[model samples]
Target: MENGTMPSYFYFTLFKDFVHMRYLILILTLTVYLAILLFNVIILFVVFKERSLHEPMYIRISCLSVNDLYGSAGFFPRLMVDLLFDTNTISRTACFVQIFTIYTFAVWEYTILTLMAYDRYVAICNPLKYHKIMNSKVTALYMALASLYAVFSMGLAIFFSARLPLCGTDIARLHCSNWSVVRLSCGNSTLNNNIIGFFVSATTVFLPAFFILYTYVRILIICQKISKEFRGKALQTCIPHIISFVNYSIASFCDIALSRYDSDKFKFVALFFSVGFLVIPPFLNPLIYGLNLPEIRKNIACLFQRSKVGHFPK
Candidate 1:
């Protein structure tokens, strides 16, 4: 251990263990990664280009898609390289960057979900005041606050994890996470490292999740008193949000699982769980929202039709 820095490189035993399935995993990873990119990018493009889709709810959904893309890009490129090649190791600085990007993305995933839930609540429960509550200023403020909150919360854990002198070089997981890095720190003398890491993540992740669930419950109760048609509309919107939350929860659960049960027996299982959160929601979100929301589906169909009509002879 050195005073100024930790290990120069971290070799992932998780990737190393996938000797037989490396190529298979690489193919699958590439497919899912591409899907994530294609889907989220379309959402962003459509949202920005179509003036009709520029409402607060659509804007919030766009931000979530961007967050998902950012998260997928942070991990999948590095991970795909490892899967296709033998370079299971990553530079310490690069590892830290991944840690920050991924954790911040995860934190904001929850934050954005919380805000989306609030947006839905207002749309359903206080329809007349929706615009008043979710004005341009308010929408921007929600996003800014979510980013800042994620940074302060996850940044604390990363700070604790990064400042410590790592005693080992091998991380048992596919990517560099704060917990994996913190565990390499030698002494249990301080309360700052792992303890704070867990506390920071638990609070940051769970509190937002609890809040999202609470908001949905209220939304559900309120929907019951409304007309059946309106209730169906609410379900159509909220179902995707719930599914995305579950997607994220599964990814977070994978982290805990790997830390507890990293072994040869779980290598294949680990590979599936490791990439699920990053790939699944991004890959599915656009499809979920696009297909479920009538306005988006209609806009997309019109977009394609316009493209088709433009290509024909005048």
Candidate 2:
């Protein structure tokens, strides 16, 4: 080293390594997230435009897709920016807002999946009364209730998490999460952590998973008595919900575990699962529902063709 200068080789080597991997991760995240966003937008448009997709199942699917869109959109973009710039600083207010939005959408997603399970249970367990039971009014009420519950629960979680007075500004992760942020507080966080942990596990993990499993068991029992055609259709209808539920459950556990621990190894594992859960389900959802369902597939193809021709070519 010359004249108080640092070692060039060390700094340069680290910089090179970081630049290489950072670019790769950034590109990959952008491509995956943007592709999913584009597909989701297409699905939303198709559902809005096609009168045929106004049924209860598609309605629920649409809501779930929208939640996925918002959920991933909340955190991924910020992560991408931080990765590229090596800047992880976020304002306290911004952090709280992010926590609120992410938590709300996450809870909403779990609630939606639970409702979908109930939807399937009704459609399969009582085919004759499915229409009468899942009428628009009842469905609307369920949606409204789910939305309200998610908002209040997430609000309470945020309130408790935010109350811990900050001793310092250091955060370990790319973005502010309730757990990471709460660790910085000067006040006792045991109660806050317990409350958040309980609510998150109960609603997102236990309740939804239980309902899904119960519904599927009922579905299987019902399938044994129905015709082959009906059984096959019923199984297909439940497949997407099963996939979403499993993804959510795994991700929820990984996140809760990550929040509980401060180890770098655990954080890395948790990050992988968190991103996987967020991205995989959203990408899989359209393929599961749209590709398998004839109406949605046709509408998507038609929509693409019409877009290419530019509105009847004047």
Top candidate (lDDT): 1
Identify the leading candidate in terms of TM-score: 1
Query: How would you encode candidate 2's per-residue C-alpha lDDT over 114-205 as one tens digit per residue?
Result: 88999999999988999999988899999898788787877787787666655555554555567766666564644657777587658755
Clash pairs for candidate 2: none
Model 1 earns a TM-score of: 0.91
RMSD of each: 2.7, 7.0
TM-score for model 2? 0.86
Pairs that collide, model 1:
none
Model 1, stretches more than 4 Å misplaced? 1-5, 309-314
Candidate 2 runs further than 4 Å off? 1-20, 266-268, 305-314
